[model samples]
Target: MHLDNNTNSEGQKREYCSNGASRGGAKIIKTFSSRNTTQNLGNNRFNNTSNIGAYENNPLIKSGRVSLDKTYNSRTNSKFNNMIPTTYETRDISIVFEEDRQNAKHYDMLEETDDDIIVTGTNCDTPICFKTWEDMELDPRLMENIKKSGYIKPRRIQAFSFPLITAGYDIKGQAETGSGKTAAFLLPIIDKMLKLKFVSMRRTPYALVITPTRELALQIHEQAKKFCLNTPYECAKLYGQLEKSSLNRELDGGCDILIGTPGKLKDFTKNLQINFSKLAFVVIDEADRLLEFNFANDVNEIINSPLCTPISKRQNLLFFATITKELERYSMDWMRKEVATIKNKRENEVNNKIHHNIINVQGLSKNKLVVDLLIDEQKQAEESDLSLRKTLVFVERKKVCNILALMLMNYGIKSASLNGDRLQKDREKAINEFRSGQITVLVATDVAARGIDIFDLDHVIVVDLPKDDFMTYVHRVGRTGRLKKGTATTFYNPETDYDFKDNLIEMLQNLGQDVPDFLQQ
Candidate 1:
């Protein structure tokens, strides 16, 4: 990396360096000594902040410091520097990047890589290596598909999980939502299918992907389909929302990659003659949620049913937003004997994309507080053209979903409600509308917190915190900050949930968020 020595107005020698390779050039404008850094997608450095420029509106640069010379890209000739600007009104995208991941002080305090705590029991025949997707020598078609989907680089989980799964090892991956876990599993599975030239016939499945919610199943289906294009494979989605006849028709059609909920799969196996006898690979997405009482029995029954291939024969991949050591132990009882556990570091696992926060409040003012916050967000969106896409307000009780939806509308905020109690069609419609940007706010329960993937969601506010541990809190706020960095602000009312206080403080501390002493007790 090259360093730029320049003097600020105060005549202090300030050192600014880009993380990218240093390009030797023009004589030093000025010399400074101090450590301050800036990084970006394109290898662009800006140390000449003296002259005034026209494109001063770039939010990443200080308004006064922005100048025509600094804003122009020397290579691409793009107007807004070399980096592609996101459609949303955003500030420095790399500002929150954790330098600790390097040998720097950041990772020393709270590292983003779980290399320290990893447990590898799988006796793989081949050594796991490579740090990026390019190094892996994946299938040409799959690589082309990945680039078409605009993924320039693989995230940490994807980098680590892909090699293991491709080598045919059972793995449990723990990463926050939006960290690209879907591709981490799907890419390897698809590549293996292509390599083996495997094909599934009607009434039989080669691959089974079970998720906690239909929404997540559909999300995975959409991405998996993109990867299956132009290949000798097809993608089918099975959820409770389909009618009996329609579901039967899909089951009759060939399913190279079958994505569905556990309960629906069990129903099909019991009544629709759906077969999984030849299942080669099984992905239990959101494994922790599958263990919840609402789904645990059905999930257990499906995996152990005679229709499913034996655990010893088929490869297994379990993924969750959060999985503790105790929970991992619980999952281990069912996983294969030599399952590989893949976990991103705790600091990185808490959804770093979202700005996490907790605001203490009395129970009664909770509604008003949420309304005021939404109003403020709306006003800011209008002023900055950030385009508030969707705000999800999560509560513990199902009834509160409806109550908050109506109350938000009464307060002049357009809103929707999503919960398990709603009809399957209604549930699908709610998800579709919210995703299409037709709806601004959605009030939901914990049921929608896990497994549901909503892109471009602007914010997630927990009106009432869950009594569960830190994992639930992470999933609740993880609804946003995807598509772009969003906010996860929660309201903490001690009177309503005194038990949540300690976990809240501990989570904030671990996630690198501030914890006020008032909430620490």
Candidate 2:
């Protein structure tokens, strides 16, 4: 019999046969008193220290039953049969070793790699990236809710952000839209809220989320409700056009988490006797959009409200699809100077699964082109035995959005329009119809570009590209390709869009898409 060296669960070095042998049998054959320079298993054996580790750590081998060769069983070798327990079966040993090798390799990778996410800030103290929800040590009820929500594991952003936020450090995080940034901040904050006892005397909220748009505020509130299920926490949303009485009713009924837009939140602080002493968390979502000239003053006033918690006292979190130096500079005025920034290293890298195409509409009409594209998409879906394609057509102005919806309807295409000018109820109806597949196409302005999560979106058609901001173009196309493969087609007019051509060409090249000849000129 040929012998090979291996260690058991205990630190005892012993030699065993390559064919098969139990730990007790190995102990009897060769108990090493000192280190050996080399060892042999059989004529077919090879020397490799890696295999030794695999064999020593393999569960099957450690359980006192190493697989035996079928040839050994054929030979009525009484001595060999006696050494190996009959409980062990004759099976292919390579499969067992491969599994052990793969497991060890994966463990090593997990230990050695942190390149997937990039984090940086002033005096940044790095935070742990949890691989599982259990690693976060979340409340049992919260964990149950998370599982019920079908979140098996936290996304990369969530993995890194959870620990930082849970540790009560102000963080500025940037990730691509629809990358689960909401849940990253929400889960950790909810976990913390569950730990603190609710004070009966407290009148203000425990946490406040300020978003750029009303639709986004509603979406966040909806998601928060799911996580807060079966818990004592209550969520309320405030935005423009929400009846004052209803807003008061939500507040009077006791809201633990209040989510709202700047204008309405600013009004609430001025009109209502809301207390901010109990507020422990503050989150600014879509920080780039909220910092725009139109919303910036209101955002500043709301944050600086006398009743609001001092910047030093509360944990602050700012999330953005695209983080900029200007936005970061503005944030530092209100946020902690030492705020740690967690960013997805791959944020600028567009998904290769999304196909991007740009057409110069110098002479052709964009309206007819969009209609043709939608019709073609419908035909393709039917040919492929797939569901009807759901698409979002983006325009630059509310007028164009309304006009395009009407034009589509005139062309016998069932469509809806979502823009800021639309009534709140009307906007919600359009979103619901489009989301439910009752309407295949929804035309909107930049208002739908951020913080809106729609599943299974098949395509995005940018009928009117943003005037100057390339990131706005990114956000527009971001409407689709969320959880599935999608396509984005932009209608560019060189006459008016010449100034923005270079930006578009650069973005297309970065995404590995071909830039058109016209744009090259």
Candidate 3:
């Protein structure tokens, strides 16, 4: 049947176009038959006249019968005359009759199918990975904003995380960086708040999102603002760099969703007396990083404060690129006993879209090598008539980060340094400059660049391989190839990085890339 645009009883016009037969019509017909059989069996079981009279007299049952009668009458009165067609071919679009659309309200048109992603936990319903924005049935206003934001569909992480979160499940989600994790948690939370008609109150928020780094927190806050545009909801951000007076001003105006770092949020809860008793949702973004020893105390203080809602009363969400034992332990301590865990099945697999190249800088000056690489990249971009390719040069130490950035500038390559030693404003400036294409290269330390999302990043140059952890390499390379194809080159010092040679070779082989002869040796 060809699907066409139709207005439902609520006067909301929705397009139900699809190819071939209508899935909604088939489900409605099946449900109608099943319900009829159930009613027939109940009538037969209560055949006795006295029992029938008693059942009919019951107020609840009588009301239900009247409601069903009204619903049936309404359907018969619809444009289709009570007949729901399975297929109506008109320009190859399937049609759903008005009555059938109303009946299908309680039934979901999309069915859940198994895929590579894994979701498991106690008190978890069958996972429904929403394939499209329509499957989510979000607020029309929110959906409009989503379209304006230029998102055509939900990412895998968003697809799996939405249904569970909207249904009030505490979730621990693990996905790679740049996988739309922020929106996965934000959209559902905002939708629920809108449905509940939540109002922003002074110093009290309906949702709280905590992240480890200021950059990540700001990024999340920026996205939240975009999603909340034209809605009554208000969003506020707090971090070490933000002044107390600014935060106070924001709270005084009102806040519905508060995003911040652990230390700054803890300070507000203890001193400013910002109440979280009414918070319905609490999200810890980058959970694996936030649960580390340095952030443990502040996180504990913020979540455990009496001003905050108890763990049992609020829904908690933890999202991270990597899952660690410490994160598991923290979840056990703070999250409910029946928390839902959603993990991307391809988390361990390297992205084959990224072309991996290894350069053996055996006793040679690495600075000259990087200069040559950047110059070659620029030449290629110019030849292709494309913009200068954005690149991230990862260094192991802060000293190296600064030195390399300065050296690049001296060589007429626009470059900036991002490290822990820089002030918050400087860090923000560097990131902004890099994003705006003012600087082609961002020399960064792993700690400062973690969880920062940059779009259209073309290349990642690893000046030094992470000493021990293989996951660090994964994260560093993850910055590029975020939503498209990219490249990564790692300078390997056989003597300094000897311990990671085997692991690096295994990773390269798994990703379907050729292992260099030096590494294989």
Candidate 4:
């Protein structure tokens, strides 16, 4: 269902860069000087005002500087001009302060240790070798389908979970969002169901797949259809926002596989429109997300429905990117102890598929600064030959999202706002247009960030600084960087303290991304 909320009527807040410098061009430089200074005589050889470096035992200061000049080589280790004197100067200190605040939050979130703590699920520390479809002994036709889709090897999640799933064993698959968990369960389910001569009971879904949001449900349905193209396997999507009568007809005709969001699935079951009496396999995609406080009750009731449970103990597959303490308890209680738990390593995963960058601007005026960035991007897109089609800009609040959408439309950029406030139909239309290149820009709230999967997106803009949480930041950036190569530009006010920016940089480093120097101010 399209969730709607009150949009903020206030205009964008005006904020100036704490420092007059534009984020357009900046280079991070590392400078080191030889120790050849006499005591009592000044040894400073570079401008140390805005950024300073202290020497420890070795009587020379080295500083890393970021510059935007095309000629600026950040990778090169060089010395500052020695002839000039070095002195500490004051510039935009806001970014420095912001960094400190962010660092404090990061430290607070850590388990008060310098070591990696296993937060959830079993840590499979072994090196996971991804397997090819042939190696996995998947159905020949299915393997051909995977190849046609350009998927020669199974992703870590699929490689680990598919074998157990086909063996009729219940399993829990844990991996990050971009790890291809959907296909892990879909392939095995299709293979098993295609082996059957007939689908059981009219108006009953034999296999039920529940997702947290409609967009995600539709995405899974589309992917399943691609996999089952030439086969007898039939998959249909059932969600509330659609016409109930038409959906009921599909169920009555008999569907081999059914995919839907929690609320709609429960409604159909309650009305006795869909039956799961013959159901064999149950898959909960993004199980942890569906179990969030917002959708927990609905998801639980839907899972408990008769259609989801078989006459005897059935094959249950649960997939979640990250599981919290509460979700862990629920899983232990619901899933049998003997179930195979597959956790894949994501070290090799990179959006070789996505180009990521950050715009570190200095200032307290976040909203206004973001607007400026969006406008600049729009100009670049227009100047180009429609190359920047299918762009998504994220906002922190629903109100801000609406305002930004309005602002973009006012500037002749065909844009639509998507949030809980818009009707489901409106959201669907907007998403379709964005995908089709009808609308170039989509201003969205966080709701769209997690569930919606848009392919071949040109750009993803985080209009405001994401919370200190890296997972939240990852989800926002994940919107654009699908299988195809894409670009992500995150905006941040420069006044953030050095430590706060370092915390963010540290998180990105752990994720294996190169943090842009501008943000490290």
Candidate 5:
């Protein structure tokens, strides 16, 4: 196992090893070589003790292998997997659709118009607390559904987002996933679709919503239909591994709205069966997830289609809780110039957000640590007479997920592994069992992590800390304490140290959450 090492500002040795065990069940003690020594990494030998650090400034590993700079691939060693190798190359192309492109460019710039941007100067000074749909004046039927669904008031994000969307302004909204952001955009699209006269085209929806996971696409479609109930508009979901005969029939018959993932949508589009030109409102839910799932190229193709038009000319809404610099760069290149950005409250007390501390565990047994926490939570649940809802345990590898699930089952704790290796049917079944209270624990990878939004999740356990960006750490923990309602715990082995954990603790403290003592070490 590799140990993450560090040095103090004074150039003294620091604890930088993860707590792991030897094959014989003995804890391994990792130390840095202070004396000048050359250590072999792969095929090359460098001074492992040098001030600049061993292998410093080397683009390739000691074995002289070139390393890609992509964060996820670099951290997860995805380069070695069956994952596709992405090559970056620039291209200059002619704009055959020059008219539409100009329109898109103009609108992109228009988004920044000071007089037209209602959210700019006002909300910059205070938290939003107004009725989000005060201006939309949704159809009575949709309002009735919202009432019946027990939604009495709009969330802080919804209050500001609804008006902008209904007014036909392009939006770049950043809010928590469960903060009613889905309905904030969907309600307006459904409202608009209902008012437009229906052209007799079957299966083709006027509005298209894209998400990273099939589960999320279905979830949004259900919510969208609920809003358009009793109206003339109809919504359909398209995804992989479904009966194609039925989907094609629905397309031929004409639908008012389409919700699907990129892969399935791309397949349909290539077959010339799905029409994009008629689409007016395009929604990309969980936009960050699109890139993480390796769907950026596909999403770009969809955006560049004749139907999507340019960002400036078409009505577009991109919604996701986490946004990165890479996403911003992509947006600036493709989205309208005047995109209205609505940011949520930063990690603060009012928001009640929590972040984890990186406890550098060195030479400790990870399995033993996990067992201890599970036992503790089990005991507490029993004492409180609380029926354990579902708990999600995250792991980095499929092999680990299966092994952990088996271990939990051997302990008489019902658990299952959900990963890409499993068949789609099996994955759905496991999720159903977890959601229906049949199983208490579900072990998954990051792909499933981004898609799951189960209400009232009992807890989230991070068996492995992500080596990717800090944003991924946020998304991992984001699975728990949803709406600030639960608790989350991460295992810190001995190899891991307190430096990263300290930064995480500060972030959580700023977000108004309590820090655990174990992490303070």
Candidate 6:
């Protein structure tokens, strides 16, 4: 090694050193023009292909050249990189695709997802959350389904709620729709079932899940099937629409897990001869709706029925989208006294995944405005070279849904109607057509489409706001952002919808959307 000292014209002392493998040998060495040879990196713009002082300051390798993203190491480093170059140059590059833009935007929301986890109740221990579901050492079959379902990481709620339930502690969690609470409870339940196999054949179901609606039950059933397909576990869906003979046959055949609504299941208690001695786990999803919809007596009947085991031997899980005095009181009785309460901390009151807004439509312009929206969407799709996307319009009445569907068709927009009045086959066909993009618009009552996961749905319009239940509004808007980015627009009539304004305003603000004063309370 050799050292050299020099003084620049500014009278600043600089020290330089040279080193090689051998005493007299010379090798590749880096040079920097700085007051100190160590290169203070103090406000000095780097223009050459030399290593930066910090490990995170490495050149962003893009297009076979260095990209001077001020804070760069790799493309996955962070979205906060300063794109404005300081001294290093950039080369010709192609336009970034929408996928890349979405990735960048998703990375940018890391700060927004830094919500706290507030857990309460007795000796319930919080779960150690793994970065990915695979890290939890789940069964290979379950892990495969999770990956196929596009699960990259367990959501915050899933990470926190898993342990409490797995430990046999009753849980009451408050999580909003689309927050992945389904899998949070389902996964732990499935895991427990896989390990609880008996030495001999068991007659009664080992678990029971009661949901507010048949659609939600069916949704959970589908997910259950996906995870339990390759295993020996059997899950059955019980509802009133099924034939008595078929229901009896399924019950006779045997079921390890049962999912259904309280009313239907309560009817089955007398209508079908079944065993419930082995029942161990009970989940009451959407507990608030279960109580409000007058299913409380039926649910209590099922839980306290002599056929089932006592509360001491059973594990209970209750979930609600929001916290309220009534829900809390109801949960205390059903959920064990020392049950764990897991409440998701929200960065905002509204789901960040969906964009929410209201379209003020005059008396006669409602139909015309809807038609215009379809036309503009088509035009924008053609301009962007994207495929025509699907849209859903929610109506308050089954009759209105049919009329709106007809109006849209008369306007030359491919559309269909779906409501509780439609036959099962007809409703299924309508849903299939809309999902396949055969028809670009679907007009339906909220109850008809609950728990329907349309992967690529692009828009949702609420034509008739529910008079009281804000959950109707939440479920309507939540339909669009199911598996991807989506937008929601409500046809607001200030006079009729004045009761909905406060909730609407709160929802918009939680989604980080700008709101008007009239809508604000």
Clashes of each: 5, 0, 11, 44, 37, 0
Runs off by more than 4 Å, candidate 2: 1-115, 122-126, 200-203, 346-353, 383-386
Question: What CA RMSD would you report for each candidate?
Answer: 16.2, 26.4, 28.0, 19.2, 15.4, 22.4
Give the least accurate 10-residue stretch of model 5, judged by summed lDDT. 83-92
Candidate 5 residues 1-521, lDDT tens each? 23445443335433333234322345544343332212221112212233123224333233333222211223355532221111222111121122123323322222122111125522246434345344457777777666555454565567777766666667888765445578778877776765665563665668888899876776676666667667777777888876889777656644678888999888887777776777787788889888778888888877677655466666888887677887887777556666677776552112233233233434433443344345555655677687555678888887556545544543445566677665555566666556545568887877567646664575677767777355665677777644434445565553553445765666656655445545565
Two-way TM-score contest, 1 vs 4, winner: 1
lDDT of 6 by residue, 100-174 (tens): 233333433433453456788756365455556765667676676665554557777787788677767888877
Per-model lDDT: 0.63, 0.67, 0.68, 0.58, 0.59, 0.62
10 residues in a row with least lDDT, candidate 1: 84-93
Candidate 1: give the clashing pairs.
Answer: 53-67, 53-68, 100-106, 100-107, 481-486
Put down candidate 2 lDDT per residue, 133-231, tens digits, no spaces: 889999998888776655656777889888888777899988876567888888988888788756533448888899999889877887787788788
Give the best candidate by TM-score: 3
| Candidate 5 lDDT for residue 301 | 79
- Highest-scoring model, lDDT: 3
Candidate order by decreasing lDDT: 3, 2, 1, 6, 5, 4
Whichever of 3 and 5 has more lDDT, that candidate is 3
lDDT of 3 by residue, 1-521 (tens): 12233332334332221212111223210000111211212312422343234335445344432111100122234321111001111110011122122323322311221125689984546678898999999998899877765566777778988998887789998876656688899999999988888877777899999999888877777778778878998888888875668778867766799999998898888884688989899898887777652787888888878878998999999888788777788888778887888887776555555667676666545655576556655665577686557899998876556556644554446677777766566677777667656677888888654678775587898888887887778888888765655678787887899998988788877766667666767
Question: Global lDDT for candidate 3?
Answer: 0.68
lDDT of 4 at 319: 81
